[model samples]
Target: MSGKLARLQQQHDSLQQEHKALQQTKNQLNQELQSIQRTASNAIRISNERNDLRKQVADLTRNVADLRQQNRDLSNESNRDWFLIGAAVVIAGILIGLLLPHLRFQRRRNNWGAL
Candidate 1:
């Protein structure tokens, strides 16, 4: 009877140790699961932010392109205006050179007839 009782007590002690080890393992796994959840959430947030940044960059790029086109158009028109002004000035100078001398009056003087 004494031998049987000691064996049963040994078995109960071993079962208790195994239960404690299993509980510890369970706690560790739960912590790891929580860590994974946090990591996944952060990944999702970062992906969304990256997408938003891409969209903003695309919009800004298009805006810059539009501004460049407008600048080119304005510069071309300004150049054309300056060219016309220069042409008018040159034409006026040419007309003055050709017509100014012809427009001058001739001076006349009375002279006595020679025999």
Candidate 2:
């Protein structure tokens, strides 16, 4: 009877020790899981920020392209305007040159007939 009682007490003590150890392991695992959850949350936030930056970069790229096109169009228009101005100046010079000679000849003829 004494041996059976001792055996039963030993078994109970062993089970208690095992339960304590298992509880410790469970607490450690829960802490590790919480740390992993925090890491995952940070990763998701960084990924969303990265995606937003990419969209901004894409929009800026398109804006730059549009600005470049506008600059080229303005340059072409300026060049055309300068060309037209130059043509107008040349035409005016030719008209002045031809009209001045004709006026001088007519005045000289009218003076000779008076002489």
Candidate 3:
């Protein structure tokens, strides 16, 4: 009976030590899990920020293209207006050149008749 009692005591102590080691391992795993969660959270935030920046860049590129098209339209209209103005000036000059000489000859003929 004494021998059996001593053996049981040794088995109980061994079981207690195994339980302690398992508890320490559980605590370390929990700490690692928390660190992984924080890292995942930071990664998600960075991904969202990167997506927002890409959207902004796309919007800005569209705006620049629109502005360039508007500039081209305005330049074309200005060129057309200058062309019309130049044509009008040339027509007026040609008409004045043709009519002035005719008027001068008529005035000379009238002066000779009066004399």
Candidate 4:
């Protein structure tokens, strides 16, 4: 009877140890589940932010294109204005060259009393 009691006690201890190991495994699995949940939440937030950044980049690209077109238009207008001014200056220079020599000859003749 004593031997039987000893065997029964050993079986009880073994069962208790097994139960404790199972409880520990359950706790570890719970912790892993919580970690996975947090990671999923973070991934969703990051995805939203990435979409927002993409929209911002698209808007900025369109703005840049508009500015580039405006710059080209302004450049063309400036070139046209410069061309007109250059032409006026060349015409005035030619007129002065043709008129100044005649005026100088007349002034010299008047001073010498030859005409």
**Weakest lDDT window of 10 consecutive positions for candidate 2:** 104-113
Cα lDDT of candidate 1 equals 0.97
RMSD after Cα superposition, model 1: 4.4
> Over the stretch 1-115, how does candidate 2's per-residue lDDT look in tens digits?
9999999999999999999999999999999999999999999999999999999999999999999999999999999999999999999999999899788453445566676
TM-score of each: 0.78, 0.81, 0.74, 0.64
Tens-digit lDDT string for candidate 1 (16-110): 99999999999999999999999999999999999999999999999999999999999999999999999999999999999998897877755
Q: What is the C-alpha local distance difference test score of each model?
A: 0.97, 0.96, 0.95, 0.96
Please identify which of the two predictions, 1 or 3, would achieve the higher TM-score against the true structure. Answer: 1
lDDT for 75 (candidate 1): 100
Clash count list over all predictions: 0, 0, 0, 0
Structure candidate 2, residue pairs in collision: none
| Candidate 3, residue 62: how far the Cα is off, in Å | 1.0
Candidate 1 vs candidate 4, lDDT winner: 1
Q: How close is candidate 2 to the true structure, as a TM-score?
A: 0.81
lDDT of 1 at 17: 99
Ranking by lDDT: 1, 2, 4, 3
| Pick by TM-score: 1 or 4, better one | 1
Model 3's TM-score against the true structure: 0.74
